[model samples]
Target: MPERPRIRLVPLAASLAVFALVLRAVHALPDTATGLSAEMTAGAKASGIKNVVTAVLLDFRGYDTLLEIAVLMLATIAVLSLRTDPDALSRRISGVAGPVLGALTRAYVPIMIVVAGHLVWIGSSGPGGAFQGGAVLGAAGILLALSGFARPRWSSGAPMRWVLAVGLLTFIAVALLPLALGGTLLQYPDESRKSLVLLVEILLTLSIGASLTSLFLASASDTSEGERR
Candidate 1:
């Protein structure tokens, strides 16, 4: 039987009430944040990033962003833990990809790769960055899957693991590097700020791409396993 509307409304109302309370608390603050743009703009210049928003995310509040990356990694780990067998897609691996869709994927994948790189490159100065570029790369991965690309018994081999971990490792290392130089955590020295930010963005973009693609592959694996059962 379908759920009664009133039963659904009970939980819905409770959630709404909680959300309203949180909003009220926020409203009570005399603007929880003020002069945020000015601060971010100044910091952006100092961080050697042309985009203030990007600087804020990857440099100014980098510790927070680092925690967010950790959360993403944890989520990926949780998803991987849910899979019982990684080899379930072995037979499906041999299927040939062809026809118009395959050709289209071939064409698009390279373009997406280039576009993603462009986004990352321009991100320091414009309205793009690791997340946007990573999303493009993730889309390319999906397109590849649609083109009948198959997974190995373990698609997530050492290379895959490295791609997944590189961004995080680099970020932490960069953050701690300042400590070695007597700078605070995640602080980029003025001399190398631009190069460092670019390097981190490139690594992070690749990591995000791999992480998202891994999640997609895992979901597909789960679906395949279910059908077999």
Candidate 2:
């Protein structure tokens, strides 16, 4: 029989200590377990946003959300940088689209656009927001790319780059604007809070959609059949 490996006392002790700390933290939880719901609800009301999630995300925790979008921008840039094919953005999925896919895409893309717009607009008072709307918009773009139904001529140009950047740029601009007026960063002036948030959401939808589509185009280069003429 093989000799059994000896368990290290030091590691065992460390593991026990970590487990003890976790248990202690768990035990410290309040019996009622009310959580921060009350505070968050108050904050949402103070912010004048009917959607608590949106208020928390775009208002109370703006910096974190800002960093999230910035991360997405960075990720898109990284994906584009790593692409081996120079003409990836100009390429589309190869092979002809079947009539069914072509027809569905033609009918669905417009509806998706309208749905995305509704999501963005209703976010302030409902369940949807920029991220949700952007995701849908991005999905529509992906559907178009996959079906090879339509590829915009402007997709590979500087305008597309601008679309990819407008979200973060506008977020940063809005965050800094408060500083010039003697307030903290991202402190929206009461009068224009809703307006600023709406603007940011709209730009974010565009940028997020463009970024996701660009990432797909860049990353799919190797797998695609051939560049379209």
Candidate 3:
């Protein structure tokens, strides 16, 4: 008899079956069960945040936010390690972008910064929050990089690193302080919840902005060298 091909399809089939079963189970969950949703809604109101999703992401499930930031940081570091020169692509792109884009970038950077700051400040009671603000700030950085106003070498790596860490460190500090005071981590019953949430949001905004900007520049630099050749 002829030998069968070595490739296995049984495991793949089994995994697909398992995934389908899990999806079905998830779909069967009660849509009307208001337990988790209600709690989040109440937390949003109590924290004075208008956006329920932001409240859930930054305050109700703050530990998850920290982990998410860590994941982004780790992914960035991994990309940097694997790349020859990250900024190469962006730099080359900038070279061909022409003066119009450069002029627009120069004109818009300050406005973007102001808008990002406003979003962070109003996050406790608005649709905008840290992630939104961070994205806007990252856009500004991209503009700066593309316009040739700031190079990766000219930017301060140390200060940027500190900005990236500030949110995680602040969260840790707050959570640990509560634990040190004989309470559970992140249990902020004594202090004003709104205030605490706002502070965290602000730090997260800055940290995420800095981290994203660094990642963009790093990637651009890595890719730029290749394009130049």
- Looking at model 2, which ten-residue stretch has the lowest summed lDDT? 220-229
The C-alpha stretches of model 2 lying farther than 4 A from their native spots are 1-28, 86-92, 152-155, 223-229
- Highest TM-score, which number? 1
Local accuracy of candidate 3 as per-residue lDDT tens digits, 1-229: 9998786799989999999999999999998665687778887777777778878876678778878877877876666577665446545655444679767886899999999999988776667898999999888877777676776543335676677788878877776767877878777654476777778878878877877877766655444345779
Tens digits of per-residue lDDT, candidate 1, 53-118, equal 888888788898888888988888788778666654444545467688778877889999999999
**Angstrom error at residue 174, model 3:** 1.7
Error of 3 at 167 (Å): 1.9
Q: Per-candidate TM vs. native?
A: 0.87, 0.81, 0.78
After superposition, the stretches of candidate 1 with alpha carbons farther than 4 Å from their true spots are: 1-4, 31-33, 150-154, 222-229
How far in Å is the alpha carbon of 72 misplaced in model 1? 1.4
Better lDDT candidate (2, 3): 2
> Which candidate wins on lDDT?
2
Q: Candidate 3 vs. truth: CA RMSD? A: 5.1
Across 1-229, the per-residue lDDT of candidate 2 in tens digits comes to 9999999999999999999999999999887787778898987777778898898888889999999999999999998788787465445445457899999999999999999999999999999999999999999988887787655444556888899999999999999999999999999998888889889999999999998887777776544446542
Best-to-worst ranking by TM-score: 1, 2, 3
- In Å, residue 98's CA in model 3 sits off its true spot by 4.2
